[model samples]
Target chain A: GAGVSQSPSNKVTEKGKDVELRCDPISGHTALYWYRQSLGQGLEFLIYFQGNSAPDKSGLPSDRFSAERTGGSVSTLTIQRTQQEDSAVYLCASSLGQGTKNIQYFGAGTRLSVL
Target chain B: DQQVKQNSPSLSVQEGRISILNCDYTNSMFDYFLWYKKYPAEGPTFLISISSIKDKNEDGRFTVFLNKSAKHLSLHIVPSQPGDSAVYFCAARPASYDKVIFGPGTSLSVIP
Candidate 1:
């Protein structure tokens, strides 16, 4: 695709339910990132993946929030027992690689609402 | 802690005038800064960027100025047009870090 792709542009789920968000980065891009943004708020880093190495999961808010990148092309972010606070837009971005000059391209984002 | 911040939540400017958006960061390790433009119900797109070594960078009608000593940066859009009315976000890439820190964003309104 021309740009990053995210699945299920909007998802509404009940509290305590597990929700999964997916992202398909631009072709051949080596780095992928996940971010979360609340209503009218700044983006919060969620996770990062570089090539085949272990993903940088330090930014995950809690253990319930986990992400896995398969084959370095697509990624899935799963939130177990979603909370009201988890209601936010999940954004996916990708860059060429780890460089200061490399700019990231973003997806339209998936708005997740936990009721 | 909020490393990157845009104090102004919104700004209004007349078309054909200059629109200035400011961003400040507490982390001194940031060496690369970028500005992004976003529209409602859409993704953000890259507008301009500046490195710490360069005090200013210009791309057509857009320019970014960086002040390393003050840990501040600003994006200037000359001859702002109605199409430029959108939320502008400031991002910084810290030294040796792959993730970029993003600001809350400032909504820019260009009126004709």
Candidate 2:
């Protein structure tokens, strides 16, 4: 991919329904990250996957939020029993590596609306 | 508590003038700072960055300055243009962590 690519740019679902967001990082990127922006709030870190290392899930807001990266290339973020508060823009980013020189490239984001 | 803060919600600047965006952080462990510019409907793009070891870094018309003592960092755009108008976010990275904390963002409008 030319850059980080996210799918289903916008999603609208019932409050209790489950939703999944997909991210296809740039080819050969070794690091992937997930974040979200709620209304006027800043970007909040969710999860990170680096190579085959165990993901850093400290930033996940709750048990309902989970993510998985397969083969260190494609990633998926799933929200279970979504609430109204979950309505926001979900963003995905990828970088060459997690070193100090890491510069992330982001996707346009998927706007999720929980009715 | 917010680790990073961009107090001003918005800023307006005239074309050919300088646009200054400020950010403050409370965490002392942050070792790297970056600025990202975002336009409506698009993801943010990396603008400039400065390391804690140095007080300043510049690229073309964009410059970033860091003050370790004051826990503040600012981005400056010289001769601002209308095309530069967008929401700018300030982000910081801790030396031992891969996560980056971001500010609320400040929207800048450059008038022609």
Candidate 3:
């Protein structure tokens, strides 16, 4: 793909339901990131993956939030027992390198609404 | 506390005029800064970026200015066009950190 791609552009789920969001980064890119954006809020970092190294899950809000990147390519963000506060746009980005200076390409994002 | 901050929520500029958007950060460890522009229903696109070592960087119509002393940075769009209307976001990353912190965006309206 020419750009990062995310699945389920919009998802509506009841509270306590589990939701899984998928992201496919650009080919050959070694770095991937996940972010959450709430209404009228800035993008919040969630997780980061660099090659086959362990992902940096420091930004995960709680135990209910978990993510995994397989083969250093596709990634999945799973939320268990979603809460109303979990409603937000989940964005995925990819970069050719690892670091702050690398330019990240973003996907259109998945808007999750937990009712 | 917000590491990166864009105090102005919105700005309006007449077409052909210069559009200046400002951002400030409190963390001295931030070594890289970038500006992104986003339209409705679209993901943000990279506009310009500057390293802490340099005070300025320019790309065709967009330029980024960094003031390390004040921990401030600004993005300037020369001869702004209507197509430039969108939400602009500023992001910063520390020297060794892989995560980027984004500021609350500023909505820019380039009026024709």
User: What TM-score would chain A of each candidate receive against the reference chain A?
Assistant: 0.96, 0.97, 0.96
**How high is the DockQ of candidate 1?**
0.77
| lDDT value, residue A84 of candidate 2 | 98
lDDT of 3 by residue, A26-99 (tens): 99999899999898888888999988888889889999999999888999999999999999999999888664
The residue pairs that clash in candidate 3, if any, are none
Q: Give the winner by TM-score: 2 or 3.
A: 2
The superposed Cα distance between candidate 1 and the true structure at residue A61, in angstroms, equals 1.5
Clashing pairs in 1: none
Question: Which 10 consecutive positions of candidate 2 chain A have the poorest summed lDDT?
Answer: A95-104
Kindly state the fnat score of candidate 1.
Answer: 0.66
Give the C-alpha miss distance for residue A67 in model 2, angstroms. Answer: 0.5
Model 2 misplaced stretches (Cα beyond 4 Å): none
Tens digits of per-residue lDDT for model 2, A58-110: 88999999999988899999999999999999999998877646788999999
Q: Order of all candidates by DockQ, from best down to worst?
A: 2, 1, 3
In candidate 1, which residue ranges exceed 4 Å CA deviation?
Answer: none
Per-candidate DockQ versus the true complex? Answer: 0.77, 0.78, 0.74
